[model samples]
Target: MNVVLFNPRAQKAHRRLPLSLLMLARVLDCEWALVDGNVEPGAEQRLDALCARPGTVLLVTVMPGPQLGVATPSCRRLKARYPGLTIVWGGYFATVYPEAAARDPGVDFVVLGQGERTLPELLDALRAGGDPTAVPGVAAWRDGGLVRGPTRASVRPADFPDPPYERLDMERYAARTFLGDRTYNHHASAGCPYFCNFCAVVNMFEGKWIPDPADHVVRIVRRLATEYRADAIEFHDNNFFAWEKRVVEVSRGITDLGVSWWGEARIDTMLGFSGATWEAMARSGLRMVFFGAESGDQDAIDGMEKGGLTVEDTRALNRLARRHGIRPEFSFVLANPGDPERDVERSLALVRDLKADNPDCEIILYMYTPVPLPGMYDEATKQGFALPKTIDDWLSPEWAGYDRRRNPRTPWITPGLVDSVYDFETVLHARYPTVSDLRMGPWQRRALRALSAARWRLGWMKAPYELRLLQKAWGYRRPEEMGF
Candidate 1:
């Protein structure tokens, strides 16, 4: 049996090694081949060629929304071309919407939640000619309906195999760096502890915050630094500071390695970290930190169920991080459902204040995208928002909030209002793109700010992608530089 895994090509500066797929490969008992759709343009053709010499060929894919749109059609085409191929779907989208995913005849099985334990067992069953229905954390069609197996228990990082970095082409993957060099991405924890309504991380992990043992994290960091000569590390955890002790231990261990690192943490969570811990982390080479501030207004924050986090907390954290010599990146969502124009202004006000306080601070603005997970998706439909009806709709860049340039997922907000906010955001990015830009002459900065204001005042504009190439030709910059 040929076990193949794929990484869907994404349009980002960094190509993340499909860490989950590599880990699954570590525990599997059969010979496996890893395929990167990003590096291999003719991935489908390669799969087709493999099927010619195979007995039972299993093609497993883990994808998010945009990739799913591309993969679903590709899978359908492959199934039609070769009937013997076994197709499996996993990852955030499939775990949240198994029934919808399995409805596509091309997908023979849906691996729910975590795949480390369930995937190997499913493969074993297939190899032994036994019923795969007994395998937990799996969803498949039976009697013309979706049948989901028992939910598998979530595992901490210690339970999984060490990340199979050997499976990826390390030289081909590079993360865009803001302060330091691009580094290898790793996670010290699993699942976010927060219950923000817009979050899909918690839902996918079954609402558990699991961290790898401190020793396990230290060992991995040391190996990456000594063996791979990694100059930096990106902790891809949803919230790296979820456990204070774990943060202290991991930071202290990596301190001697002298590798600058980055990670995301909530403002509310960071408030609890002692000054000593923050100082320790700084000495450990924590150069950059990302915060999902979500919104500036307390009301908007409450609306998202992002418990008790306020604009004040964001302000304090920005100041504190700056004091510690750690560059802070704050992200905000504009025009969320149930939020009014005044709320949008409040978020803008917060951004202006933060920039004034710390000109070097990175501010990210996003349109509130409606993700179709259990809690948030239920709320969206209840509020009369239409969910994607077919696989193609799910794949369409216009429908998914993550990829859409013009569509606003928050139906409650008018299109004109959304456009206005985005226009203001364009101005914001134009003026304060990065920390280094702070060194620009005051006159040059003021001129760009005036231009941004003029652009917004020019009225409703098409989405960025619609005008990206023209803007690029105008010598402003490319859409990719804008973090598209």
Candidate 2:
């Protein structure tokens, strides 16, 4: 059976290829094609082109929260055109809400958790004219009811090959950096060890961390550098520094290849490394590292069950990273459960302090968005926040995940606070534009700042989607920068 995989475009066109779809394609036994909606003119055109070909038995669409809405209409259109097409939904969104996802008429199956093994197994069954219900980690509709199955075990990273970048138009991809032209995205591991209450990663991976062999990761890096002519690499792992020794080994391996790289890590994990270890990583070309400094106040951190993390820890780590010639960037959440006004101020103060200490340091500020994860969704529900009750709810344009830039307010976050926190972040983005923001010109930068100030002053403004439109009009963003 011929299988087609679709990746709906983000709000902005992204150069980084979809790794989940790539991985799924890697293990599939039948003829398969990957259609990226992000680069295409429209999702409908892409789907129509694929469906025009005969003998296409199955269609798969991967959902990252933001693109779920974009995929809904395209799936419906394709189903109408090709009634025989078996539409399957997978990836982060389906893993969390299989039943709700299956409720959508366009979606015939929902592959929960990981899809590498599950997808191939399901396809094999379909090819044999066997019951798809026998496949684990899949939810399908049968007899007017949803049939759900247990998730399959996570696969070792070593067992899977690097993403199938050869299937994509590599030249069409570009990184966000000035040097992003030759940049590529990669992952040496899957899943996170920590269960940060607000994070859906833990729920998606069932709190299990699976890492690839260090040597194998080194080989992949070397291949990327040698074959793809990649000058830079971004390790997209959520917890790259989970094991200090493993990180050191990987860093040294990359250093030997003479390629500069960046990745994200928890602050405590970075602190856990000794001075010499960090120095080794820095010397090896670890140019930047990101930490989830979720909030500035300890109470806010505790409220999120972000264990043992403190503002002090954040300050120390940023300082140390700068000392070692590694740029430190942070992500701060302005609104959280029970965060008093003072707590928000503390977070802003920390952002200012980081910039003052090292103007080069990057700070990304975000309002607390309620996603359908256990700890976060449950708490938000208690606070009178309603979770998306069905697939249609998730596909709603106003869904919180659609656009973080626009208003996606939680019940706990008053409209005034959302405006305040967003205005604060916009100012910071103007002052210390991240290293990746090398393309924005001075005129555009000033315009963004002025726009932010105007929105903030007009506190009565209910919803502001125009700012995002303005940002695009000014050529400040890539097609993949914003979610659709």
Candidate 3:
């Protein structure tokens, strides 16, 4: 069977291949055509021209935000051109909200949960000219009615197929960097054991943390380096350090290969690992590491149910990573339930201190958007933050019919304010120069002020997206110097 997998773009094309489609192709054992939905302006026309082929089944993968707008229209056009083709939709968005996606006229089937086994089974049934109505994990329309199948079981990371890189556009991605120079993506483990109130990982993976064998993961990394020439890899595992022995083995294997990679690790894991282990990871080409330091305030951290690491533990983790010559990046959540002004001030102070004390430490702040999956939204609403009427409202403007709802409990700041603060932080970091003394040089400070003045003069300060696009375009033109 000929299967065409589409990746709809809400932003510029990133190098990572959609792992789900790769698993699907392996399961079906079919010839696949992969297309980037973000082509130059008339690229969709070119896509339509290519998709108008005989005996092809179109499977478009979509994410929740802006990508849905692109995917829905593209699917509609593809179905209009080839009425006999089977069009299926799956991804984060479809899995979370299958009912809304099933309502779309262009979607023939919506596969929920893990698609590894279910997708192949659906394709097999189609090949046998069997009815799709009874297919598990698939939602289909039959006889003018919607039929929802039973939920499918989740598959382990070890069970997924090796991603089909040969079938994808490698040249376009080769020009891009993975986390600023890394080039591979891997999931050594599947699922997150922690039920972070605002996370979708637990919901998607059903709170199951299954780690793949160490040797199997190492073999995959070896292939990525030898075949793909990937200098670095990003372990996409939700909690990569959940299994210590597996991490140590994988680290040793990659170190043996002389390839560098980075991944998410918990603070406790870093502290648990002896200094020698961190040294081994550094020797193995692990350049960057990310820790989920949700907040510096212990109370806010407790409120979010993230009690794994205290502020001191996080500081120690940062010091350990720096001591190993590894760059540590902190992933933090800005606001949480019952958080006060003092909490925000304390968090910012911690960030400032980290920057001052550890030059290699980088801070990434993410807003605590309440997802309706399980704990987060209900808790936030109970704390008196008004949620949007539906889940779709939380999506960004580029997505179709997205409505940004205001939170009554957190009336001190608006969602727009949070976005702007992040944007400003990016601009500030980009325009300013880092000094060994942990102070911006005079010229750097002047440049930042000048840039701020220019932005204000042109009314760009209020337009975060526009300012970001300009910055990105500028960065792309001189990527070698951009450090990204």
Candidate 4:
């Protein structure tokens, strides 16, 4: 029997470590092949070769956007060619919407939540001719309906084995970004602790966070620096700063390694970190942090249950990050379901304020996309927002765009309003081109800033055709899209 691990291609410049597959590889007590679609030119060919034998299991990690688009077609083609092939879908999409994958004729099983413990058991059941869905965190198609096992939180990261870096081509995973030429990625923590209603994490993890100890994180960092010569590390955790002491310890231990790091943290949580902790973070080369200043309105923040985060917290963090020389990349969700236009205007005003407070600060603007949880999702459902019933429907252009949060066409937001939000973003990008684009040099940066200066100042952001053309010519990528 042959086992293969697959990560569907996300997009260009989106190559990072396939952490999900690596974690599963460490625990799977069998010979397996790992193929990363992002780096492997012959990913499908390699998968076909591995999955030729009888009882071959192909495990795929899929996200909601571009990855789903590619994986859907690939799985359909493979299933049609090999009747004995077993396809299993995991990752964010599978956990959040298991029926979408389980209902698909190509996918035989769906792994929910975490897979370090569940996947091996499911494979054993399949080999023994037993019920695969009996394994916790496994979902499968039985008869004509979907049979889902019990959902649970992720297991402890400490119990997992060391990263299986030897199994992968580290040079391919190493990426060029604002941090360094050879930036790599790691997920040191389990799910996030807070339950932001609009966030997809809630649907899967239900507000639980488990992190590896500080010493363990230090060991990994040292190994990456000494063995792989990695100059930077990006923590792909849902929230890396959940435990203050762990972050402080990790920061101090990694200081001498000279590796710049970045991670996501809640504004309210980081604002509570002591001055000493901030000093430790700065000394350890904490280059940047991503915060979900979700909305400019305090009411919306409260409604979303962001763990008591306030609009003022966002402002204070911007100042604090400036003081520590750590750049703040703030992402705002524009156009709330209720009063979409007003929500956007308030957020735009806050964006201006954030830029004024810290000119070097980065801003990411995303249209509001509802997850399957309460609060906003209920509002969305009332406004005719519904999940697709079949995998093919998810591959449609509108649903694909919805997954990316760039073009979600919620009924609440009007076409005119969407255009206005995008126009504002275009001007914002022109005036403050992201520093992440290593190719944009001094003169190019100056030209962009100068060209969009008048429109930004006069608040005339409508129809900035010149700015759009120049951006396209330069091939600019926004900070949000760059995984900042």
* lDDT score, candidate 2, position 362: 75
Return whichever of 1 and 2 wins on TM-score: 2
Put down candidate 3 lDDT per residue, 1-484, tens digits, no spaces: 7788777765553446556566666666777766665434566765676577777778878776557767877888788878877889987777767666776668888887777778878888889988765788888766656687777767776876666677666544442343334365777777777777666675577677878898899888888778777676778787887876777788887786766677887787678987677777788888777788878788877666664568888888888788888888787776665654555557766876676668567666655666655555676666676643332453434323321112223534456555554554555344322221123346544655466556543434455564355445434222112121
Query: What shift in Å separates residue 135 of candidate 1 from its native position after superposition?
Result: 1.6
What TM-score goes with each of the models?
Answer: 0.88, 0.89, 0.80, 0.98
What is the alpha-carbon lDDT for the whole of candidate 4? 0.88
Candidate 2, residues 85-204, lDDT tens digits: the string is 888888777776676778887788888878888888788777788878779988887776779776688877669766777888776664545434577788878898787877768767
Clash number for every model?
Answer: 1, 11, 2, 0
Which residue ranges in model 4 land beyond 4 Å of their true spot?
Answer: none
Which sequence of candidate numbers ranks them by TM-score, best first? 4, 2, 1, 3
Q: Of 2 and 4, which scores higher on lDDT?
A: 4
Q: Number of the top candidate by TM-score?
A: 4
Tens-digit per-residue lDDT, 87-176, candidate 1:
888887787667678888778898987788898889888889877768999888788788877889777766867877776667665544
lDDT of each: 0.72, 0.73, 0.66, 0.88
> Among all windows of ten consecutive residues in candidate 3, which has the lowest summed lDDT?
475-484
lDDT pick, better of 2 and 3: 2
Residue pairs with backbone overlap in model 3? 255-284, 260-285
Best by lDDT: 4
Stretches of candidate 2 exceeding 4 Å from the true structure = 11-13, 52-55, 142-145, 174-176, 374-376, 400-406, 442-474, 477-484
